[model samples]
Target chain A: MNSFKQKWLICRTVADVTYKEWSAYRTHSMVSIIVGPVYFMVQYFIWTAVYGDHPSLGGIELPQMIRYFGATALIGYLTMDFADWNLSMLVRTGKFLTFHLRPIHHRSFALFQKIGHRSLGFLFEFLPCLLIFIFIFGVDMRPASLPWTILSVLLAFLMNFYVNYTIGLTSFWLVQSGGLRSAFMLVSGIFSGALIPLDFFPHWLQMSQFFLPFQYLAYLPAMVFTGHYSLGGFELSIGQAVGIQAIAVLVTFGFNELVRRLAMKQFTAVGA
Target chain B: MKRYLDVYKQGMYSALQSAAAYRMNFIVSSLITLAGNILFPLVTLLIYRAGTSFPGWSLYEVLLIQSVFTMSNGLSSLIFGGVLWTTMSHVREGSFEVILLKPLNPLFFIVATTFSIDSAGLFLGGVSLFIFSAMHVGAIPVLYWLQFAGMFIAGTAVLAGLTLMMAAISFKWVGNSRISELADSVLHIGKYPLPIFPKAVQAAATMIIPVGMVGFLPASALLGRMHASDYAAILPCFLFLAAGIWIYRHMIRLYEGVGG
Candidate 1:
C-alpha cells in the first residue's frame, strides 16, 4: 500500500513530462495526428479501387472496408508510442542519467509517458479527423459494443508499451538505434497490419505470426473492432497480447540491468 | 561544366566512403525499401483476388508498374538519399543559410552533401523484382528492354522532381507536406494498373498531381496499353526538368543567411 502511492506519483510525473514534450507545437501537432488516418486512408483508397472490381472481399464489402479501415486508422494511431527512443541514444548522449536523477523506475516512466502522449495526441490530433470520417462515411460504430473495444484497446496499450520499451532497450547494445528502428518499422509494417491484415498473408506467414510477437501489437486489437473475430478469438488475442507483453517487459528489464552495469559503468558525464 | 564534374566526383567519393562506414545500416535501409514495396502489394493482391480481374490486367502487370516505380524511387534514393532527411533538419534548425553560403549552387551542394549510398541496395532490389515480374509476364522482345531503360530514366527524373519539389517547399515553414504525404500514398495506385481507378480519378491523377507519369504511363507503354496519358509523359518529362530548375532558384531566393 505504501509503495503503490509512490509508483502512482512517479507515473503522474512522467505523464506531465510527456505532455509537455509533445505539446511543444500547438497547431502543428496535427501532422502526427493525421499521420495514422492519412496512412489508413491511403490504404483504403487503393483497396477501394481493387474492391470496386469485386462485390465482396474476404467478407468485407465497400462500406465495411471503409468503416473498418477508418477504425483501424484511429486505433493504430492511439496505440503508437513515438517516444520510444533508443536507449543507446540516451546512453551515447548520456541522457539516461537524467532519468536516474529522479526516483522513478525508467521502464514505468517510459510507458506512462508514452501513454500520456498517446492520450493527448489521440484526443487532439486524431479524434476530430476520425469523427469527420465516421460521419462522412456513415460508419456503423455500434456504441453498445464499446465496452469490449475499450478492453481490447487497453490490452493494445499495454502491448505497445512493452514492445516500444523492449525494442528501445536494444539500443543499449546497438549504440545508435536509428537503423534498428527502421528495421523494426519494416517488420511492424507487415506484422502490425499497417500494410495489410495478417489474415491476408500466406499460410506460412500467418503461422509464423503466432511465434513472433507482432500480431498482438496492433493487428489483433483492430480486428476486434472490425468484428472479424469471435468473442472467444478476441479473448485469445487479448490473452496472447498479455502473455507476450509480460515476456517483453521481462526482457526489457533484463536489458536495462545489463546496460546499467556492463556498458554504462564505463561512462563519465560530459557535463561533469 | 568542368567544375560541376569535379563537384559531382567529389560528392560521389565522399558518399561512397560514408556508405562504407555504415555497412550494416546500408544493408538494413535496402531491406526496408524492399519490404515496403513488397508487403503492401502482397496484401492488396489478396483482396484483389476477391475483387474483379483488376480492370483488364493480371497480377503480374500490376506488379510491373510498381516495380518500375520502386526502381525509379530506388534510383533517386541512391542519388539523393542523405538529403531526404536533410530537409527536415535544415528547416527546423535554419541551416538553410550554410547551403546558401557555399560557392557552388546551393541546391546542388545541399543535395550532394548527403548522398545516402543506401540506394545501391534499392537499385538491386528494384532490378531483381523488375525481372521477376517481367518473367511472369513472359520474356519480352529486346526492344522492350531498351524502351524500358529509356522510360526508366524518365521515371527517375519524374520521381526526383516530385521529391525535390517537396524538399524545396521545406524552404518555407516546412511547406506543409500534407499534400506530398497524400501524394506519396499514390504508391498504392502505382502498384496497380491505371484503369483500376475510375476514369475521372485517373484523369485527375494524370493532370493534377501528374502521378500517372511516374510509373503508370511508362508501364502502360511497356504492357502495350498505350493511352492518351502515356503521351502525358512529355508533360512531367520536360515539366520536371523545367520546374526543378525553377524551384532551386526559388529556394535560393528564400535563403536568409544563417550560415555565419
Candidate 2:
C-alpha cells in the first residue's frame, strides 16, 4: 500500500510538471480549435455533396457521420501523444542515457509525462473543440452509454501510448527511424479508422482489422460514442467492444515490454 | 535572375549531397511519402466503390484532380516547404540575423537552402496516378496540355505564396508549427470539386484565398472543364503571391530578434 502511494505520488508530480511545462505553449494546443473545425467543415461539405438525397451511406446517416468525425477530433485530443517521437529522439540523440541516472524507469516517466500532457490537452484542446462541435457544428456529442464510452476512450488512450511506444523502440535498431515512423503513422491513420469508417473498407480488409490493434486507437471508441459498434462487418455490443479493447491493451502492453527489454540491450549511446 | 539560378543550383547540389550521405533514409523517406500520398486516392476509390462520388465527377476524373493536387503540392513543397521550418527555426533561435547577413536575398537563400528531396515521393506518386487516371479519362489535345502547363505553374505559385505567408507568420508567432496544420486543413478544400462547396466558400477559394487555383483550376483545364470565370482566379493567384512576399518582407522588419 505504501509502494502504491509512492508510485501514485510520483505519477501525480510528473503529470503536474508536464502540465505546467506545456501550459506555456498553450497557443500550440489551441491551434486545434481552428484546425479541427476546418477539417470538420471539409467533411461537412464533402458528405453534404455526396449525400444529396440519400439518408445514409455505408450504414451511417448524415448526422452520425458528423458525430463520428466530431468524436474523432475530440477523442484524438484526449488520447494523442508524441511518445514515439519523444522516445526516438532521446535514443537517437543519446539523451536516453541521462535517464539511467534516475531512479525511475524512462517508460514510467514517459507514461507520467503523457498523463500530464494529455491532462493539459483535455482542458485546452478537447473542451473548446467539444463546444465548437456541439454549438457551431451541431454534432451530437452525447454518448450511447457515458460510462462505457468513457471507459472505452480511456482504454484507447493506453492502447495508443503502448502502440507508439513500441514503434519508438525501433530506433534502438535503426539509425534513422523517421521513415519507418512515418510509414507506421500512415498505416495507423488508415487502419485506425481515423481516415474513414472501417465499415466502408472491403470485406477482406475489414476482416484483417480483427488482428490489428489500430482500430482500438480511434474507431471503436468513436463508434461507441456514436452509440453503435460495427467494425469490419461485425456488429458488437458496447460492452463486448470495450472488453476487446481492454484485452488488446493488455496484449500490446506485453509486446511493448518485450520490445523495451530487447531494445535496452541494443542501446549504445555513441556520443553520450 | 542568373545569379539566383546559380544559387539555387548550388543549393540543390548541397541538398543532394546531404541526402546521399543518408542514402537509406532518403530512399525510405521518399517511399513513405509516396505511400502517404497514395492514401487519399485509396480513400477516393473506396468512396466511389461505395457508389457515391462528387456530383458531375467520375472516379477517374476525381482521381485526376487529386493527382494534380498532389503534384502541385509536391512541387511547391519541394521548392518552398523548407522555408516554413527554416524561418521558424532561424527566427526562434535568433539566427534570422545570419539569414539577414547573407549576400543573397534572404527569402531566396532560405528557399534555396531548404529544398526537400523527400517530396520527390509525392511528385512521383502524383505523376503515376495522373498517368493512370489520364489513360482512363481518354486523350488530351496539345492545346489542353498547354493550358494545363500554364495553370499548373500558377497552381504551384499559389502554394508557394501560401508557404511564404505561413513562414512569415512564424516571425511573430514563434514556434507555432500548427500554423501549417491550419493552412493544410483550409487548403484541403482544393482537393475536391469547387462546385460541391457552398457559394461563399467557392468565391473565397477563388477570389480571396484562391486555393481553387492550386488544384481544381489546373485539373479542370486539363479535363476541359474550365469555365470563363475560372480565368479571373489567375490574377488573384499573382496578387496573392505578391501579398505573401510583401507580408514576408514586412514581417522581417517586425522581427525583433529572440530577446526583444
Candidate 3:
C-alpha cells in the first residue's frame, strides 16, 4: 500500500513538472494551435474540388467528411508524442542514467510526462479547433454521445502512448532511431486514417489494416466521437471498440516491457 | 571563386566521411526518406481512386508536377543545405559571429560547408517518380527537354532562395525555430496545379509566396502549357536571393547575441 502511494506521488510530481514546462511557452502553443486548421483548410479545398456536386463519396458526404477530418485533426494533435525523439536523444547521450537515479520507473515517468504535456494541448489546441469546426466549418459534433466518446478517446490515447513508447525503446539497440520514427510516421499516418479515412484506400490496403494497431490510435475513436460508428451502425459499437483498444494497449505495453528488458541487457553508456 | 570551390570540395569530403561513419543509419534514413516521399503521392492516388480527379489535370499530370517539385526540392537541399542549417543554428545559438569572422563572404562560406548527402536519396526518388510520370504522359520533344533542363535549374534556384529567405526570418525571431515550417506548408501547395485553388489563394501563391516558380510553372512548360509570361517565372529566383541576403544582413546588425 505504501509502494502504491509512492508511485502515485511520482506520477503526480512528473505530471506537474511537465505541465509547467509546456505552459511556460504560451506563444509557441498558440502558434501550433492554428496549424491544424490550416491543414484542414487545404483538405477542405481538395475535397470540394473532388466531390464536385456529388452528395457522397466512400459513404461519407461533404459535411460528414469535413467533420471526420476535423475530428481527426483534433484527436491526432492531442495524442501526438515526441517521446521517441526525446528517448533516442537521451539514450544516445547516456542521459538515460538520470532516470535510473530517480525513484520512479522510466516508462512510468514518461507516461506521466506525456499525460501532462497533452493535457495542456487538449485545453489550448483541441478545444479551440473543435469550436472552429462547429462554428466555421459547420461540422456537427454529437456531444450528446460524450460519455462513450470520452472513454473511447482515453483508450485510444493509451494505445497511442504504448505504440510510441515501443518505438522509443528501439533507440536502445538501433544506431539511429530517427529513421524508425520517420518510417513509423509514414505508416501510421496512412493506417491511422489521420491523412484520410482507411475506407478510401483500396480493398487490399483496408484489409491489411486489421494486422496493424494504427486504426485504434485515431480512426476508431474519431469515428465513435462523430457518431459515425454507433451501436446500430454497420461499424462496431463504442464498447466493442474500447475492448479492442484496451487489448491493443495491453499487447503494446507488454511488447514495450519485453523490449526494454532486452535493450537494457546490451546497454552501454558510450560517452559516460 | 576558387577558394569557395575548395571549401565546398572539403565539405563534400567531410559529409561523405560522416555518412560513412553511420552507414547503417544512413541506409535506414534513406529508405525512410524514400518512404515519406512516396507516402504524400499516395495520398493523391487515393484521392483519385474515390471516383474523382483534379479538374482539367489528369492524375499523371498531377504526378508530374509533384515529381518535379520533389526533384527541385531535392536539388536545393543537396546544394544549399549548409545555408539552411547555418541560418538555423547561427541565429538560435548566436553563432553568426563565426561566419562573420570567416575570410570569405558569409553567404559563400555558409553555402560551402554542408553537402546534405541525404538529399541524394530524395533526388533518386524524385528521378524515379519523374520517369514513371513522364512515361504515362508521353515523352516531350528534344526542345522541351532543353527548356525542362533550364527550368529545372531555375526552379532549384527558386527553392534555395525561398529556403534562405525563410531561414533569414530566424535572425529577427530566433526563438521561432519553426519558421521553416511556414515555408514547408507554403511549398506543399505546389504539389497540385495552381488553378484548382480560389482566385485569392491563387494570387497569394503566385505573387506573394511565389512557390509556383518552384514546380508548377516548370512542369507546365514540360506539358506544353506555358504562356509567354510564364517564361519570366524564373525571375523570382534572383529577387528572392537578393531579398534574403539583404534581410540576413539587416538582422545581423540587430542581433545582440546570446544571453545579452
Candidate 4:
C-alpha cells in the first residue's frame, strides 16, 4: 500500500510538471479549436454534397456522420500524444541514458508525462472544441450510454498510448525510423478509422480490422458514442465492444512490454 | 537573377548529396510519402465504389483534381516547405541572426537552403496518379493542356504565398508547429470540386484566399471546364503572393532575437 501511494505521488508530481510545461504553449494546443471545426466544416460540405437529399448512405445518416467526426475530434484531443516521437528522439539522441539513472522506469515516466500533457489537453483542447461542436456546429455530443462510452474512450486512450509506445521502441534498432514511423502513422490512420468510417471500406478489409488492434484506437469508441457498434460486418452491443476493447488493451500492453524489453537491450549511446 | 539561380542549384545539389548519404532512409521516406499521397485517391475510389460521388464529378475527374493538388503541395514543399522549419529552428536557437548577416536576401537564402528531396515521392506519386486519371478522363487537346500548365503555375504561386506567410508567423509564434496544420486544413479546401462548397466559401476560395487555384481550377482547366470567371482568380493569386512576401519581410524586421 505504501509503495502504491509512492507511485501515485510520483505520477501526480510528474503530471503536474507536464501540465505546466505544456500550458506555456497553450496557443499551440488551442489551434485545434480552429482546426477541428474547419475540418468538420469541410466534411459537412462533402457529406452534404454526397447525400444530396438521401436519408443515408451505407446505413449512416448525415447527422450521425457529423456527430462521429465531432466525437472523433473531441476524443482525439483527449487521447492524442507523441509518445512515439518523444521516445524515439530520446533513443536517437542518447537522452534515454538520463532515464536509466532515474528511479522510475522510462515508460512509467513517459506515461506520467502523458497524463500531465493530456490533462492540460482535456481542459484547453477538448473542452473548447466540444463547445464549438455543440454550439457552433450543432453536433449532438452525448453518447448513447455515457458510462460505456467513458469506459471505451479511456480504453482507447490507453490503447493509443501503448501502440505508439511500441512503435517508438523500434527506434532501438533502426537508426532512421522517421520513414517507418510515417508509414505506420498512415497505416494506423486508415486502419484506425481516423480518416473515414471502417464501414465504408470493402468487406474484406473491414473483416481484417477485427483482428487488428487499430480499431480500438478510434473506431470502436467513436461508434460506441454514436450508439452503434459495428465492425468487420459484425454488430456487437456496446458492453461487448467495450469488453473486447479491454482485452485488446491488455494484449497491446503485453506486446508493448515485450518490445520495450528487447529495445532496451539494443540501446547504446554511441555519440553521446 | 543568375546569382539566385546559381544559389538555388547549389542548395539543391547539397541537399541531394546529404540525402544520398542515407540511401536507405531516403528510399523509405520517399516511398512512405508516395503511400501517403495515394491514400486520398484511395478514399475517393472507395467513395465512388459506394455508388456516390461529388455532384457533376466522375471518379477520374475527382482523382485528377486530387492528383493536381498533391502535385502542387509536393512541389511547394519541395521548394518552400523548408522555410517554416528553418525559420522556427533558427529563431528558437537564436541562430536566425546568422541568416540576416548573410549577403543574400533572407527569404531567398532560406528557401534555397531548404529544398527537400523527400517530397520527390509526393511529386512522383502525383505525376503517376495524374497520368492514370487523365488517361481515364480521355485525351486532352493541346489547348486545354496549355491552360492547365498556366493555371498549375499560378496554383504553385498561391501555395508558395501560403508557405511564406506561415513561415513568417513562426517569427512571432515561436515553437508553434501546428501552424502548418492550419494551412493544411484550409488548403484541403482545394482538393475537391468548388461547386460543392457554399457561395461564401467559394468566393473566399477564389477571390479572397484563392486556394481553389491550387487544385480545383488547374484540374478544371485540364478537364475543359474553366469558366471565364476562373481567370479572374489568377490576379488574386499573385496579389496573395505579394502580400505574403510583404508580411514575411515585415516579420523579419520585427524579430527581436531571443536573449540567452
lDDT of 1 by residue, B64-174 (tens): 787777777778777765554676567667776766667988767866777767777676776777788788987577666666666677766766777777676666645
- Report the C-alpha displacement of residue B230, candidate 2, in angstroms: 1.2
Per-model C-alpha lDDT, please? 0.65, 0.89, 0.78, 0.89
Candidate 2: TM-score of chain A is: 0.97
True contacts kept of 3: 0.51
Candidate 4 regions off by >4 Å? A269-272, B258-260
Top model number, DockQ: 2
| Quality class of the docking in candidate 2, CAPRI style | high
Which docking class does model 3 fall in?
Answer: medium
| Ten residues in sequence with the least summed lDDT for candidate 2 chain B | B251-260
- The chain B TM-scores of all candidates, as shown, are 0.86, 0.97, 0.93, 0.97
A1-272: candidate 4 lDDT, tens digit per residue? 99999999999999999999989998999988888888888988888898887788777898998888788877889889789999889888888888988899988999999999999889988999888888887878988999998999999999989988898899889855676678878898888877788888999999888778888888999999999988766889999989999999999999999998888788876545
* Colliding pairs, model 3: none
The DockQ of each candidate is 0.40, 0.84, 0.55, 0.80
| Per-residue lDDT over B98-176 for candidate 4, one digit per residue giving the tens place of the 0 to 100 score | 9998899999999999999989999899999999899999889999999999999989999999999998999888989
Give the per-residue lDDT of model 2 (tens digit) for A180-255: 7788889999989887888889988888887898899999999999889887678889899899899989999999
User: Could you give the DockQ of candidate 4?
Assistant: 0.80
Q: What is the CAPRI rating of model 1's predicted complex?
A: acceptable
Is 1 or 4 the stronger prediction by TM-score?
Answer: 4
Clashes of 3: 0
Interface RMSD of candidate number 1:
4.1
